[model samples]
Target chain A: MAHDTIIAALKAKFAELVTTEFRDNFRVVVAPARLFDVLQSLKDEHGFNMLFELTAADYLKYPKATDRFGVVYGLLNMATGVRIFVKTWLNEPDLTLPSAFPLWKGADWLEREVYDMYGILFDGHPDLRRILMPEAFTSFPLRKDYPLRGRGERHNFAVITRAES
Target chain B: MPLEALPTLPEGPEKDYLWTLNFGPQHPATHTTLRLILTLDGETVVTAVPDIGFLHSGFEKLGEDLDFNQYVTIVDRMNYISPIMNEIAWHHTVEKLMGIELTPRCKYIRTILGELARISDHLLCAGAQALDLGAFTAFLYGFQQREVIYDIYETISGQRFHPSYTRVGGLLFDVTDQFIRKVRNFVKEFPKTHADMCRLLNRNRIFLERTQGIGVLSKELAIDLSCTGPLARSSGVVRDLRKDEPYLAYPDFQTAFKVVCAAEGDCYARYIVRMEEMIESLKIIDAAIENLPAGAVNVDVESKAVFPAQTSVYRSIESMIQHFELVMPNRQWTPPVDEVYGAIESPNGELGFYIVSDGTGVAYRARTRPPSYIHFAVFPYLIEGHQISDVVAVLGSLNIIAAELDR
Candidate 1:
């Protein structure tokens, strides 16, 4: 069947997915349950070859937010010059989603970054470790509830003066 | 042990089969703030684990707190070599999110500065790579070119190193006639330096031997690993965002525009790609400077969210208030709660910003898809089967900026 746009083709392929457009970008909001399948299909079938970026946002304090987290996947079809954001949401007590590393090896570090910042877990990821923060860090700094100044984590480090050294 | 002969690899017990070497968080070759844990079987690397994030200042976190104009200062430090490029990319994303249209003059001016930044950044990367490979004179040659470029930046932004020169709707200030003359002079004089530096390294047998087959990244792996810019171009990717995306004034470049590519996906190919790209950038700057559009450099934006240039503030009373509003760091405009991902072909690669707004001037979430961050990840793969010395070649070829990686 012929489709007008990639969004239409995707919508026809997946029944549960909803598509929204913002500033010429087609954002496909997919459910967390079938994210891996959707991403794999997008790569293999739809030619969305590049997983350009993967990140998550905390909507814990958002006025109209329905979910606690919004994981965004920046994808690009280099051949067609069509770019998209494959979005999926997760709530508190269950902030886990399927990893896109299988589709793109580049997702390795990006997923780790998302994990470090927002404390979101990526299922089936080979090495999902804290990327930008210390491994011992207990809190996710990017979440809205996390204070800008940090919660005494900065003060916890032992101070060593130049005179002592 | 024989005193006269070179030491040989010891044939020893189990532990000798695989040895781990810690390379940098402070090592000279790493350019500092980037650490690598290498699992070595004798001299051949079995694996290279990049332990990074020494300079993680939470740039994304700061983006949520700082207003649009205030944020440029922070982004300026992300890619310090091409600080102006970061400013341009930040505002490019900001303007796209806020639906602000730039003036014709503003676009041309930004394009000129962006290309200048590309040349400046490539010079440093090529210089530092040569410096790592022990070609000191070539490094000096590249640095001399950079010093001239820095003078141009210093003249425009009032700060040499971190020129937070770009503002939301336009620039911090309009370019002076002297600034235009300096850029023109740089364009005229840079070729001799470039040719000299190329001669110093390109044909030098030792440099060629060290870099030719070292750290070969296949074109497939380049794409799969999300490598961009010269790294991908060198690997025969045939992709340049200038032609593909055509942001700024790249599409209107008067000179013969072409994406420089190489069939060989090695350190040598990457070197050649950067060398060719610097020439392309100079051509772009020449075209832009000659045919710069005549108009107000700042967009005639009425929105309180966008700031006017210093020239506008001096001439108009209304613009003066807008300047203070931007400077004071107050939330002045209500934008529709939406998200946008805007990117530009920066010197390093596809420098992009994914911004989410929550009906306020401050970003709800600001995510940076920096090139260095991905290139750093791809380092281990490129160096897996190479010798210890090849690590420097691969790492240098990648040009992973430490600040951008952690941020």
Candidate 2:
């Protein structure tokens, strides 16, 4: 099937679910709350079986943006080669979204990664532990509030004393 | 239900049971700083738990602090061996979002560089796999070829490893005729050298015994796991981001390549797929070089987002401002408040960037979906029934680069 036809059918079927559409590339941004239902429909009914990639973004710089955090999911149809982008928005206080692990097993680590960096909680994630950050890590490094230079340096007394003494 | 009521095995006559062994965070075979706690019953693995993230550097967060152009440097470090593909992918994504298209010349140059990076990556995989299987000569041969490619890279972009040559609108500068001539010469001789390496190791009895019929991954499992690149191709899945999703100069080039696969989906199949892919990449590089065109390398070099040339900065006031804006940290180059997922075909597999721009000088969030991380996740399951020595063989065959996996 043509990519346009697939997009048109998706818009017709889930008109209420899609919040915004980037018409140039046929990418539709959907609300985070309704992502699971729409993703399941796309997988089972629409044949968008492959979970190509799952990624996230922070929206702290945009004034009046709907959500402070955005999670993007790239889905692909292996047989037809059609790709679609599914997005979900989250506020700073509660960076949580529905988990797609039950639908696509590939989401297991990808979700944990989002949690580790963006501090977004994927509700119902099986192993919702830090995949990249150490367990002792206190702050989410990907957040806009985190300093770019990183944590302030601790005093290197051993080296300093060797030079002085 | 009482605990004291449970039956216990007799002391001396009881058979010794399975044991659990933690194999990483420092193990040589786990590749990066991955920790695998393995439960073993005699020589067979009962369950394998992979603990990762010892090498995570919070690259995503750093992306949030840098502008679009500066972010390119960070993307280059994601998969250090194959940095060009990541740079191109990020550039394409940003170009798509900004609605800018490159000229024919720029596209072809990007394709040639991408293919070169692919060759270098495949050489690392092939050489390292051979070394794991006790073939030292093959590793040296592969490294020698890679050294030549690295020299070619240095000639083009000063830097050997993290080149940062690709920008949002186009490349840093056009490839000189001399550089093109050098590339042409390299392509002419690469095939014979590659053939020699293949003959030396491909059919060797020891190499075959170690890799053949080991680490089998089925098509369904591969898809379920969302495997990409050669790993997915080796499992009989015909998918390539370049062919399926045309980007850069790939759409214009006429090249012959196959998505090599094997029904066995074992370690040997993966090895053969990469070996064959090196030849295909060489063909792509040849096509790109032969069809090189003449034009400006960058479309908007004077734009506010790009770094201005030194001559322009000295002569023109606008160029000076543009130069200052580019050089000053955290001053210019803010992205829009939208999110985009940029992906490209890296040698290991799919290297993707999930960028969230908050309409600030820095990105709000940047995440890299590295294929090596996913491949590493499935490693323990692949090595379940195999001997201890086969662990290194399987790890090498997977080509799980620590930088990308841990990042």
Candidate 3:
């Protein structure tokens, strides 16, 4: 299968950096430190040309969890139309992961969004500012600890009037 | 927060001539609520930083609280221009997560409706682009045809805007003969308006001058920024999910129509690509209608995935129990504990849902990868060297709806 070849290639190249498995397609688990290297290899060597999606998931109460947060990287090989997910977990005190901006320019906003939602820091990102939320906002809304209704953040905004303008 | 946070222009010899100009969150050029902090030297835009989230409603958070079927309503607001496509995309993901294969009739009906959504979406994009460029007549022509498409939607779903028609394994109801006739009439009549709009703008001297080379996005940059749909196709990235990864009944009509692409990678290229796509959509709709099979619109009510019919629920205890089990919050259907990312070729681009289920009716995490969000991010790069007046032309061509962009 196509996944088998990808797994074999990843295993042969970055055996120490990542652990590969099959879920949906091929899924690779990389340590936070080795994430960039693994992603670079996948893009440069394996022809994973497109970064389909880059998102983060909070696993605070997950049954199977080694870390509190997981950063998922969805990569696509446009020629073969095969997709693989590369994920890395961030522990309690250190919630930072390497940025994939160098590999794919698409990572600029995707990483910024992850930083916005989960408070997960992306080291070496050019602009790691809040994208969806306002600049003054402090809370990370997507984290498990964050409340759904929000902690009075919505009510804090001062509505401007025509007189003020 | 004060305006103190605004970054001042770098002090240099040229800094005296450069000034910051604000474009929308209110202006018509943006098409929707979007703010752009544009730095311009005279009329040339030095940089354009898109400020979004004016319409962010946190749909992803709502997705976590709602069940698979219940969340369909939330996605309906994601892309308000063509709400049915969002509903279909959301349910398509849920069905895939639960490993539910739709009936042949359901698949065929979904394909037809999905193509219709694409036509309406492209029509609005093309019409709005022309409208922004002062071609008001072409916009009127395109919108008139869009109204007919909406009429067909109203006939089938009853609600024109937010038609929550697609269910997990099937459609809400079977199409009536009248609905089929209206759609047939729409496909037959839509081409005239489509052709008229093409003639009005495609070769017009003024339209060509304004759009031909404005906002040119290279194929590499398009892929680097993860652009899709017409935006990517116009830039020579030949990736179409319908052709590459066929879902529903798309594979059935692979040769009926070809994917439209242009190598120019400009606003005109995008406009032409969208215009050509409407024709392809009409072709797909015609094929689907001709080969429409006779069967049940939905799967068996006994399957528990869908609610039981009112007649059955009133007459039998078994059906009544099934309805209560489905409608009750505590006893709703539970998907297996797993994570899956399902994507579809939305009119905008690749609209994908990344779902994490915890073996409950509700989701652990539901993330929507909106195409507009990614496409809008590349705005600063695309408009960097262009004239300020050309901004609206490019913005209209991108067709970034604020609800989808910020959501």
Candidate 4:
């Protein structure tokens, strides 16, 4: 009941900028620039208080579309107990999107993680450093283009052994 | 009070104004490779920054190479404390992506095993919390009960830890009467030792003094940080996935269990919530066992989603061919081109899997939203104003498992 209302509201508010799908729950595809506005409205107006999850998917070789990357945000309306997904598409060359930290505090680390794994820059993130990967590591291992066995980074670690101390 | 508003003390004789202290990349209180950089003025902590990622094994990258069932072994290593919960959550995500609903018998069995995992997880947390606070007796009592749970796990899955017993459509094997009896016996005999352990630490004056107001996470901050499981509930968040978004057999036994909450939002409150949750898990386990469903545990064999039974594979040529077809990649089953998120109310918190299937045998993306990662993120915020001595108390209450955190 509440999900339909929220879905309808999201569709109405983001009219041309967003398209909606309902699989197990509402899934909205929004333009990358308009993601901040759409998510702001969802948080302020639609009562989706918690930004439960944020993840990225690489569709580089999939038969889907022109976009190579998709960033997903799982929003939950605690009052309604319904989860809705907001996704924004990004392609190569310049993959940057607005951060959701201003809307939810949980987005702070989630955005950092997205930046870490997918190398997608967030415009206004306070501290957009790598959260999971080491600081000296250059490659984003989660990217589809990245090899699973890695490019010798794992084996390149310098052995630091105690000698005569 | 705001962090900036905290009173700054002047430098004293033969002492610096402020200095950095590293708690660990290896320390007893950390229990794992969690390095906390703390700025200390005398004994008071000015700021604390947690540096993680010492255990990142590139599990998500590995998931891209392995198919759904093969990835189960990897998930088992993520939340190694209660590995079975990870198995259930991983397969639950894959099944959701593939649009498969498990049988009633399978759901009930999964629910029972899940609660057993929760009991073991909470018992370990409670025990370790007390041990960190210098009460060794409580830890021993708690591990004794955990061993009982491990016995039940061994009976069902042939292993104590990292069982990898759950399958996409069902479990690896049906619940034997021996497994049921072992579980029943564990549930029947655990409460007395649990009560004794609780009495040993719950009301102890030293514990209360050390933890009552130390590292308090306010309700607003808890929700903002996406803290779940007992951590959020202890802060009076009143949100539990098992209750709010019922999965497995949680819906059937909805009224049989209680979601415990404590408004204190301190180490003591988290201890109370975890202690009560173990009792609640026992109740759910009792109800599930009493009303255990009958019929086949695995889904229809004709579906070919899982391996054919061993007897059938040995008897019939057709069954052997079916097994080979299922195992071989050339004739591997194709999943749909869609994405689905499956989450379960794990012992520590909400463990979710966001799976993307691009009409392939392997998942295009398998993202695990480990609760430990999110819960640990809020740690530096919670520990800023606490004394140096209270650091272990706060860290223990948070239950930051490095395997889950790094994965």
Off by over 4 Å in 4: A20-22, A159-165, B1-16
Q: Per-residue lDDT tens digits of candidate 1, residues B369-391? A: 99999988888888988999999
Q: B1-407 in candidate 2: lDDT tens per residue?
A: 12222223234534457666667778656655777666666777656667777777766666766777788898888888788888888787777655677878899888898898998888888888888778888878888888888877888899888889987677887788778887998898888778988999888999999999888888887887788989888888888888877788887654556556667788999989998888888888888788788887777664555667679889999888877876777566665556666677889888776665555555556667789988887686688888767778888888988778977
Ranking according to lDDT, highest score first: 4, 3, 1, 2
Positional deviation of residue B19's Cα in model 2 after best superposition, in angstroms: 1.3
For candidate 4, lDDT tens digit of each residue in B155-251? 8888887888998788899989998898889889989988998899878999899889888999888878888889999999999989888888889
**TM-score of predicted structure 1:** 0.94
State how far residue B59 of model 3 sits from its true place (Å).
0.7
Residue A72 in model 1: shift from native, Å? 0.7
Q: How well is candidate 2 docked (DockQ)?
A: 0.42
Better-scoring candidate (lDDT), 3 or 4: 4
Whichever of 1 and 3 has more TM-score, that candidate is 3
Please tell me which predicted candidate would have the highest TM-score against the true structure. 3
Clashes of 1: 0
Best by lDDT: 4
Candidate 1's C-alpha runs over 4 A off are A1-4, A161-164, B1-16, B301-305, B308-330
Better of 2 and 4 by TM-score: 4
- CAPRI accuracy category, model 1: medium
Candidate 3 docking class:
medium
Q: Per-prediction RMSD in angstroms?
A: 4.8, 4.6, 2.0, 3.2
